[model samples]
Target: MSTHRALRATVVAVAFGATGLLGAGVASAHVTADIYGSEPQKGGSGAIVLRVPNEEADAGTTKVEIDFKPEYALSSVRYKPVPGWTAEVTKTQLPAPVKNGKNLDVTNPVTKIVFTAQPGSGIAKGDAEYQDFEITASTLPSTVDELVLPAIQTYDNGQVVSWDQVSTGGAEPEHPAPTVKLAAASAGGDDHAAMASGSGESGSGGSSGTDDTARWLGGAGLIVGALGLGVGGGAVLRSRKAGKSNA
Candidate 1:
């Protein structure tokens, strides 16, 4: 191949490669939910952490809303206080009374939870900036293997992103909703007490590990992107010099 053709090909490849890396970084920065420590067993109480990332270049995340399916029939819901955020829990009357973990009938079940940032406080605008919001359920529904929590994120600039699509045929959707998979119900013994104590002891460590890994990956992506740009620039410079010499 001629010198000019080789240089043009190099630049094109570098540009496309860099763009793909950057796109992957942005695509992975979506809201996710996971068990705090040990997976919660069916019909047992456990804590769940919702990791919300700020993806907008010019706007910070100002509010988040998570909707619980009525099938969950959750009897009690509680949230940990975040310094710069306020949490609101909403409940609605169920069509029929359902039996709770305690064997008592529940008429109203929690349907939604909303978190709003206080004045001047929000998840700062960046791909790496995020906040983990936690909520503990008094009892988990036993009928399903996983809980799907659809979320809506509102930005400071009034842009809203909805994470509500459910995967079909094992294929993930563009804006897949967050989910928490439950473990099989415990055989007997005091499962609730065990889960609470275990999570309390190990929750912070688990969360920290996850955050650290995420930061490392983000840093790596940035480095790769920078290198791609440098290579592309160098190739263009060489191409221009060759053209001048050929003239």
Candidate 2:
């Protein structure tokens, strides 16, 4: 083929590839979490499993960090061990004291946990791993209806994926971070009760998140279709011009 034709073909190919990529990125772009079996009952003890995904393309996931909400005010916290990884749990002091009760002296503390993946645990390119961490705690706050676990995923190349975007009732921000939600409080529980309820729903149905992802992929496919048609049209036009020139 002529140089001009070859270049046109390449342009079309690139556009088509870009469309597919855009869709794939949207489909796979969230730091998702799951609370294993059930939501922690108000003022009760329970076990939770957090699922975190690696977002970096070039590097493998090296570390995962999670910060617990002060509302939980968990007296005890623990983690389940995983193969090929090292886990560390730290209890952080609050900047200002939070009132637990008239006689109860309590402060807003944080649980900062980090997980370092083994050398081979660095997930390969175009792949991801769902790391589950089992956390145990007791006597949660009733007002602390929702447990928001904002996590940061770090890769071997120092790329950090921060999943801290919190959603309000409406009007989401651009490039918002992803967040793992805990069960909200019950109707009579408190305002925070609603938060826990919502979290409980998410925990039970893992498929909802996947649906949102599928929509993003569909959008990407549409873009690819448009680009493919444009490239094909260009090719036809060139062929017509060549035929006329020969005639």
Candidate 3:
């Protein structure tokens, strides 16, 4: 092949390979608790999104139950309404109220949350359609590095999958619970100023920036792959035309 032809073929191969990999990644992206706040204050409220995707080739997801360990010591919890699903919050009496300062008191907070897809409201079994269950978990307890939310995913066919496996620190569990790494909530760490100023939108933007980085990377990979295929196809066409002219 000519120099130009070789370059085109290389681009085609790499781009297609990249595109394939990214596509696979999207398919395999499992249920996750995407924490918006990078460093959830030990005693502050934080929002998290539980992204649930239907991995079933044919079955639609119908219900999802997330259990918060009694040990986590969360003070308050609130669930956002999903258009096609009904959310239920279950609160249990804490051993004691989580008192912050002299005025703020959070008691009898949420211990469990369940979302049931109303008829066809479940995550549609498809290439990219999924559901996000957003919730606000408040007054995160201190002295923890990560928060693991064990989730049970149910499909329309009555099949149940548990994301309950945990690891001390070694080989990853086959079914890993959705977890969030906690950062120190200090003056420079947590968005204290942002929280106080009630400029939640800016703080939210900053928080989501970190969570979305990985997704952004995957999307970029897909775009690059497509471009590669285009370049390669052009190169092959050019090479064939040159050969015909020389013949």
Candidate 4:
């Protein structure tokens, strides 16, 4: 088959794979956070929501700790308030000096406030609890391609849920490390064809993203070939006209 046809086939295959994997929603554990509002950009202001699910089935959640990746150099961060629980924002010193100053506080605890369930209200701790937190922050890294945030979920008894995994494939990681996905270009800007081709880094050892890259490359090659053909045809027409004039 022609190169163009091959490229087309590759694109179709890649798209099919991406769709299937994305639809699977291979989530890992109960405690999880999805970056909704603002993307993680350096010096950009946005909001993020944390989705905490009851993983233990029997035991309910009591605490959660969000560890900030120091490389992002996040200085200012605030959490939304949750009822029945007191929240605390803590900071840790980064090994390297950040843009602002000292160590970066790792875990920004949104809700320390305990919950009182219906059956166990005021008497026993709650059961099957789920909560979310909205956070607004600035001073994220613009240079880096993307940002990663690993979260920990704590149960009433002291069990913790750590959803910290990074993927190499284009597919979203199962229990993916919470990430502030950044575009190669600035927001509202055009991206390179390669970056736009959907070669997103996966949180696991999957080839999903790599497969996507192959598809993109195929499509790109076809377009390039078409443009080349047009140029060549124009050159041939011009040569014929020159020969007739010389005769």
TM-score of each model, paired residue for residue: 0.65, 0.54, 0.62, 0.49
> How do these models rank on TM-score, best leading?
1, 3, 2, 4
RMSD of each: 10.0, 11.7, 6.5, 14.9
Query: Which is better, 3 or 4, measured by lDDT?
Result: 3
lDDT of model 4, residue 170 = 90
Question: What ranges in model 3 sit over 4 Å off?
Answer: 1-28, 94-107, 188-247
Q: Write model 3 residue lDDT over 1-247, tens digit each, in one string.
A: 4766676667767666766755542334677887542556665566677888888888888999998866666655666677778877787877666543223555665678899989656787764677877776756666577788999999988889999788769988888898876666676544421221222122333443444566668768667766866676777778899999999
Name every residue pair that clashes in candidate 1.
none
Question: For residues 166-206, what per-residue lDDT tens digits would candidate 1 score against the true structure?
Answer: 88768678889999888887677214322222231233233
Stretches of model 4 off by over 4 angstroms after superposition: 1-30, 35-40, 94-96, 100-129, 170-175, 184-247
Could you give me the TM-score of model 3 versus the true structure? 0.62
Output the number of the TM-score-best candidate.
1
RMSD (Cα, Å) of candidate 3? 6.5
Per-candidate local distance difference test: 0.75, 0.57, 0.69, 0.50
- Badly placed stretches (over 4 Å) of model 2 are 1-29, 95-104, 171-247
| Model 4 quality (TM-score) | 0.49
